[model samples]
Target chain A: MQDLGIRVLFMGNNFIRLLGGLWITVKISLISVGLSIVFGLLLGMIMTLKNPIVKCLTKIYLEFIRIMPQLVLLFLVYFGATKSFGLQLSGEVSAVIVFTMWGTAEMGDLVRGALISIPKHQYESGAALGLESRQIYRYIIVPQTLRRLLPLAINLATRMVKTTSLIVLIGVVEVLKVAQQIIEANRYTVPDSALWIYGCVFFLYFIVCWPVSRLAVRMEKKWEN
Target chain B: MEGQEKLLEIHHLHKDYGNGAVLKDVSLDIHKGEVLVLIGPSGCGKSTFLRCMNGLEQIQSGEIRLDGEVITDPKTKWSEVRQKIGMVFQSYELFPHMTVINNILLGPLKVQKKEKKEAEKEAEQLLERVGLLDKKDAYPRQLSGGQKQRVAIVRALIMKPEILLFDEVTAALDPEMVREVLDVMLELAKEGSTMVIVTHEMQFARAVADRIVFLDGGEVVEMAAPEQFFTQPETERAKRFLDTLSFE
Candidate 1:
């Protein structure tokens, strides 16, 4: 009430910059999530194969991704690859690649869990009913797995959105980076703006993520019956 | 039944779980319009034998011919063959996400590519036969175990398979509920449906079986008419098996 210093956000295009920054974050997350779902589904199914070699290879992939830190992955894709392999990847492109790789692995594991959670008798019943293997997945397995996977996947989606803040480290100019820039620019004119600017960023993240969490909860409750 | 056409033929079937054998050199034949019941000690591979008939369990070495086509061959289209050999499980494995009618219509409409209207009509008739026409819209989870088992039966019957395999279908049902499911199978037997049933219900087995195949230790100990097999068993193993049943 005394000197809130929130007026700096209203000064000349600062809020628009924040929206643009959030758009960048949302775009990256959407693209990564879309690709992760398609590729993750395939990886999940492959992981469930009975072949020993396939199982071993997918195990290696899943473990490698899980063991590596995402920040390190972003650096390797952004800085390491350009210097060592001479690939010209932009910061945004590098962020998407790293996030997608991480998302796909996590999502693939989720899919594998869902697929295996189905009872063995379900597949046997489908087969005994003369459904082809693909038809079994299409008509029987996938429908059931989707029902089990959706709420978990929505939680994954929201996590991805929040994690997109990490992209600011790679200089992708997302919401967190824009907030920092605005706070630094107003540091002298509005000495107390850091708290307000950071608070606004937290609000922005909440507005984006809270509804998705609620949606997941609603779907889980509805499906429970 | 011996002179009738053979709907299914098996020769020297062998199955193992990589550690040891489950079915060993088992051979049997199912004739058209015959109800054959397989009864044995638990884990004697009676259920494994029924599953093999439908290719649910792959025999390590055997020949299973369905109407003279060698369905045991690796290249055989088991899915196409399975269309003619329906199976009901110990657990009613109804598609839980689907209503009763959809579960019944799935095979006919998807695998056979039948007209939806015709399939739906047949599904209703089958459900009606099982006294489940009223439950056509209910999910599997909403039904009692016996009701779910009847729906499973209807789901199998709509395929109109040449032979149906029942893997202890009523083993999981309550005592009072078992009668309702058994009555349906008894009616099918009366109407001369070819069936292979594995069950521990000796009374129902005696009533419904045209022939009873007694298995012990993964081998066919005896095969005789239910009257002969139940009354005066030929083998010591069969006698001991029947004696244990009487003890219960």
Candidate 2:
């Protein structure tokens, strides 16, 4: 009888360890996405300001983020910052920081696009109705911007979740890292186990990300009119 | 119009967009309970002139007074002044997310800080006046163009403004829908609402206006009663403008 490699997952606590690793990935992504939304909204509004200095600064920031890759940003923060600044940041904290920086920039640009797409007459109507600038945003601009922004922002969240896979490179023992450890330990005993181990990792990622992608698509279709 | 007090005064108003003049040394006075119509060629600044009165556009050099208070001063709080002046745009510009009643009540409840119950009651009355009482809970997108414009008017009117400015309000409506919106304006005129109107609807202008101000090249060329202005314009430019309109 041929031995099936699927038994490798239940041999010890390998599956549980993979789940724990996934929790770390999710925790890092959750904190980073939450922070990005708050900061991104503020950054988005600032990007739309008419002031020359503010507009220039935000333009530079957006361009810099666009020009640099997220993987490089993670490396710079995790490896370079620790050496240059003599700081001790855990791999998880560093992952969160880099993802937040990337997420905020992407989310901020989405917000700016949404804000400017509203017709100029909307603001004029608010002013004509005697609304103060703050009240104009609260009553007219913010609500409309949110409607246009939520679906795009939700898509960014799913992308961030998938991108968290890169954190394993920075020494975070997340899912992929756990999968590698299990495969390495079983190389002699279960020589054919590599395929099953990787397949499980793929399934883990699918389970977490599929529903979120579906939600974003549903929201986009609902508001398409 | 002779004995009525001046509700709005414009003195030597100069406006430019940092280039050539859009409104050049223009001045006019609007009396209480009078309907003043401004007719002009496109880009002659009739809309810009109306926007200036509401402080929506900054003037290079000028003074505007409402009830004898200088409103064009940079130190002036335009929000407070705008509450006294209501404007309806060429496009209806109603908030799409809000229902008819909420749109009308926004200025009253948020800007005026009125009690919600009181504001809602006034909103209903204004909506009823515009024959949109049944659309109080309807969103802007669900209504016809004329219906939306009327709701825009109701939105402006709920502020209880001292004067109303209409900048080509019916220009975007269908030929059939135009009359319904104009009829509402005609009723407001009969009710003695102080109004400044810019329109291409010459017949409605003649019927609703106490006086007609003809403008060309950003300057007022002739100001006279509508009956005389329509029949016999004083300036060559004014006569030429009417000639072009008749061709249309």
Candidate 3:
């Protein structure tokens, strides 16, 4: 077995290919996170509705998403549904759909918690201020809820970034898949190249997620203060 | 006296929670430019009665008329009544995310749909009146209890309501802070804003209230002018309640 040299670390073509793959991962995460926030906010509001029927329906959706593993969800969207219903979905699209569903459930719960956490007197005060129900929500309730929700939502976005690695299982050529391909191709020439290549993938994910985690911490502290 | 305009009239106002009645057959009239302070022990319907005025707590039966219009009547628009009668809560529920200026401006801008510059000017004036103009840019969390409550009062006043309801405004403040809020309220009262205050501050009740109402077990036990109510309370319940409170 030939000794694997550190020179393989920054191979020009391999670096470009890895970056291209990382870009795809980031694109998928961004799209999914955006869709998740919108869907989550709507669902969360529904979950907190005064009507029992709407509340129950939202609760059911939340439970369904929480109970099912995201990997299974991705497979169902990418492979199972395509075969069973004659529906065709691209791997990247399926990845986005699955992650959005997961992120939305988590986000919806966060929103519900934030909304409910506001003191009951806030509503009474709003009503007392001669505000109509819509006006109260627009001026009083929604602003406070959004403030409480920001930190949690940021943390969820970082989690989504890390979880994007699972999409490679569905044949999406994200960073991990690219690293695997590079290591496999160079295995005969350099036996231990996979270790260094995988390490790079790990560092890449850490580099992307650490800033977001730091941002979340900073926001949490700022809000607390 | 008969030709004078009546600001508020409640006729046989009844409110119940489940099997228990909180306010039963409560009827009273408040004249224009009057400050009515409702004082009672816990579980008395003073707060509930104040809530009923603005349709915050719906009455099971009976009628509340504001400015010759029956608010409790099915045909009456609640939004209109609420817009005219602003209520301040004990907790001073200032929107924590909003600055003091925004909190004051929100009601006028959103509910009244006033122009931005107009609302800002009104808010600034109201904040100045409350002695909080310097803290206009500060969030509710950054303000003290007294400051927050003052901001809430200013927020309510920016709508320029015909009547302001105070649901124990000073009950939530520190001992020292209570005077500042009470001072603001006194100024509002002096400006001839018709007010219905539910409070335990007997000193304030005697100082600012034109009439004092004593409520017990959800019923109006006695309603008299502040001088008569404080000096010669007719009911044994009122005297007993006064004995229980350290009003000095």
Candidate 4:
């Protein structure tokens, strides 16, 4: 162990604070991702509508999010939006806002891809069965789309959790933020504290995201038949 | 024949895709219990004509009337009109997420607003009629191509529509699988279900069809009794088309 005394992992309340920071990370991701799913699903469905104007507007929004960087977006929301709009926004709220925008666009595109991939024959079958357009989507299209979207959606969730680390730049005090604070506090006593603390943060993210990845794989296997 | 009630009437129907026409000035009548088999070479618009009957494709001009009601006018709602017509496709298009029974029951339970028990009982009977009762719990992926087609037929039949449109339902099946689906259709014909089938199966048409309508280049080239059409086709194009089929 090189006798570097790695006790700081459990000492001076560092462990509990890391866990608290992790909880915040999970909470933000859960809320933002959940809301994004709802918004994305609606956006995706709207994008499929026959209206040209709606499609054009949604395309612009999707392109805007896809072309821009998340950090740039975060900076704009945190630094620019608050100052320009005279709104008092916290780092956590800004993070949520920025992540939701990105996640919703990605998820919306995933949903659109899944929806459009269903053969035209499927809709014809639904029509032949006397299904209304709404009923066709509810009873046929959306269910199939959901099955196709599951694996990608799970992957998106993990990406969201890891990407939540970006919030630290805006001072969200999440896991990575807490790690930085711990390392700076122990910079004199524990020379190698950065290594241990950052390592713990890495594993914390890995632990958070690993199960979701495994779930995606299991789902793909089960649905392949 | 003059006094027979017409279940569906197509009046000079015209349908067009963006680049060209698919059905042009076509007129036909389907009497109660009549079996009208449409045959033509590929791209002859037989399938498109069948689709227009059920409002899957909107006609550019003319009108379609079902049970004496105008069903092709812009005011007509396809969802309501379709309840009187059922269609089966070359690719079964069975809902992969649903079990066989659910696929059959979906129309009745959701569209017709039948109770679960009622729909399930009807689905099982349709399944039984097609010799697929044992596979009711199976998903579409678990079934053979023929089995999926059979379930698809049952899915349409469970609606008990007045007219059934079959668009080359056996074309995608293996040679061996085609017999089972054809047998089920033959059974339905024996039961006197009104049917419009677009197919290349000359033997089946000769056996079951009351009238054979030959279409070519989006036009109805000829209509005659199966014996008349098969033994003595009235049009040169149809004779050549049949000649091509026979060489295979």
Candidate 5:
């Protein structure tokens, strides 16, 4: 049981496999984050409209996303929809779809908060300056909204990256999945290898997320000053 | 007098909020290049009247004309009217994210559709006029209340409006800061820009206003030249209001 020993941790083959799986995870996160930001901004703008119909539609979408768990959402997209609707979605595509839905809702709410937090007088001042509605947004509303929304959006990006680990459960062969395979193959020779493998996975996630967290903190401090 | 034209005309202007009227049947005429000051106790609808001129507040049933064109018409284009009538708010609502230069350039570039370089050149001149040229690159948060209000004035002027509306522009400033903004306004007045100001500064109004309109309880109580209105004050309300301020 001790034949493989702790030496497997530094093996070149194990490192290459982990990096390959991590590359998949990175691809999923990046694609999902980009889609979420574009859709979320549009939805957020719709939600802020004075129309009752648009407001209600946005509220329904936001609440639906908020009430459902992300894991359940992934399962529905990956398993339930594929079976019930005769869909032929791959694990990676399913993960992207589910995470983008979740990220979009969260980002939309963040955008709404940023837009509304601006003092009402800012709009009034724009009107007084003879600015049209389009001009008001271009010159006044958007610039301020972007400044407040940037940090929150960065935090959301980090969240999406961390959450990519969950896609391994759906058989995506991402980072955590590779870690599981390594630990399973060496279970007889390397005792307690699962714990060490999982520990390494933790460090990998930390390495990806730590810089983003530092950037968020630095931005907050810079803006506050 | 024969050549000078009336720039603004407010006729029987009535404004109401829900059940009650805020401004009731108020009428006045302001001539070109004249400074008209509206002074009254709080809640007297002076600000509301100023807001109506710029189409910020809708009137219930009355007419406001700017240079012989009916501005209060529902069909009249507000953006067009707004381009000619620049308003400075009480709170000095400068775009907080933009630098003083950008804030001033926005109106010129957007409403006036000036090119960036041309807008920048005009903004530089306006900033210099307001004594804020050195602080062009500074954001609103970095400026004092007086400086912010002066930047706001430049922001409005960059549109090159024929008439300027000042809605208690100095009310938000410290006592020391008030004079600086008022001095800027006085300079604009000397340059022959027609101006309508709502103010609590009785001394400044007395010193600079060509006509003083005293309002109370949502109605104009007296409208006359500064000298006759202050000394004679045809209405008891105007005299009583002046007496309260005389001690201060």
Candidate 6:
């Protein structure tokens, strides 16, 4: 039996390399999720409008993004855009941009659902109370919409964090990329390096996502109360 | 009593609900401190007429004047018009997630931009009027149907509008829950708050309404004192309406 060196994880600065990769993954998700939320909220509001032009435009954007898989979007932005649009975009930048597009579409749909789920009488009640349109949204409509959306939004965030593993395909050097690097370095010396490193990679992703989903469930419970 | 000043005047109002006219040539005058109860069968335009006064529904061709200011004109801002007229609904439409005090405080605090301390203080008294002072910290879901309706009334009163419109408010309440909400309205009536109420409660209409307006088929068919209307109901449609509600 070939000696399975479990010691490669403890190899000088190797664990830190994995942590650095984890940090990169976290950074990409945060930046992408944050940008997606602001744009998604506006898009969501636009999608709810009765204006035909705005409704049609938002519908097109949402439908187009939703129909294309995120990985293909990443490929198009990373490789295809630089070739076709005469623009230069780094792998990490492309990853962030692609995730934002994907996340925004999902987020916007969630927000639209949340806003429409509210009874029509709610807006009428606010208007009848003499609230201006802005005040109606700020005080009544927005608050209720937010409460209905928070849990789903958080769940989307978790999905973003997990799906970020795909960024390794675009050469972003995220956690999975770092695991592959570790396995490649020990491939000849350690027989079980792939299994060990992949197991750790799986553990890292779980630790990142499980708490977020748990928080989502807990917040849903709180919203119900 | 006939010399009272007109508070809200709807003249030759018409409203279309995309397919056809819901309100046709409707006209009405609500006098200051007068409790006018609107009674009609479903789809008779009473609710549409009530909503038109509050600018919750747009009228096709007409003028609604509140304190002599034209509200139905194309240039009139709904927020400005609605500030003078408060409308409550059958569904209560209370902000379910908010505490009772906060729900009442929202209009005064956000719309009127009143101080929080002052709004909350007055809201407490208004809640007290509805006998829900103890439920100030409670959310709408925690309250009974009657309690929610009463809280909704308090929400409107805190705005201190010149006139209040009630759109079939008691129609959604349980038999036991209806009176508590009606009692709040009766108290407001005794206190001389000018109110336009769309209700099915004949006893409430007879006791509190200074005048009753019977609407049917998108038109006002009869307008008279509540006792006279309850006993007389000039039109055949109104007579049939009361015949159905005789048990109430």
Best by DockQ: 4
Docking class of 4: medium
Model 5: colliding residue pairs:
A1-A189
Q: Count clashes in each candidate, considering only residues at least 3 apart in sequence or on different chains.
A: 0, 0, 0, 0, 1, 0
Off by over 4 Å in 5: A1-6, A9-12, A50-64, A76-90, A192-196, A214-225, B1-3, B115-119, B243-248
Alpha-carbon RMSD to native, per candidate: 2.7, 2.7, 3.2, 2.6, 3.1, 2.8
Structural similarity to truth (TM-score) of each candidate: 0.90, 0.91, 0.88, 0.91, 0.89, 0.90
Q: What is the TM-score (0 to 1) of chain A in model 2?
A: 0.93
Instruction: Return the lDDT, model 4, position B132.
Output: 89
Candidate 1 vs candidate 6: the lDDT winner is 1
Model 3 C-alpha lDDT per residue in residues B75-180, reported as the tens digit of each score: 7677777778988888868877778888888777777789999889888888887888999999888889999899888888888889999999889889999999
What's the best-to-worst order under lDDT?
A: 2, 1, 4, 5, 6, 3
Ranking by DockQ: 4, 2, 6, 1, 3, 5
Question: Compared to the true structure, candidate 2 yields what TM-score?
Answer: 0.91
Off by over 4 Å in 1: A1-4, A50-57, A79-89, A222-225, B16-21, B60-62, B68-70, B174-176
Residue pairs in clash, model 1: none
Estimate, for each residue in B87-165, the C-alpha lDDT of model 4 and write its tens digit: 9999969999899998888899899999999789888888888888999899899999999999999998888899999
Question: Measured by TM-score, how close is model 5 to the native structure?
Answer: 0.89
Q: Residue A145 lDDT in model 2?
A: 85
> What tens digits encode model 1's per-residue C-alpha lDDT throughout B110-148?
999999999999999888998989999999888999999
Evaluation by lDDT, superior candidate among 3 and 4: 4
Put down candidate 1 lDDT per residue, A71-134, tens digits, no spaces: 8899999999999999999999998898889889889999999999999999999999899999
Residue B215, model 1: lDDT of 90
* Candidate number that wins on lDDT, 1 or 5: 1
lDDT of 5 by residue, B143-228 (tens): 99999999998888888888999999998899999999999999888888899999999889988898899999999999888999
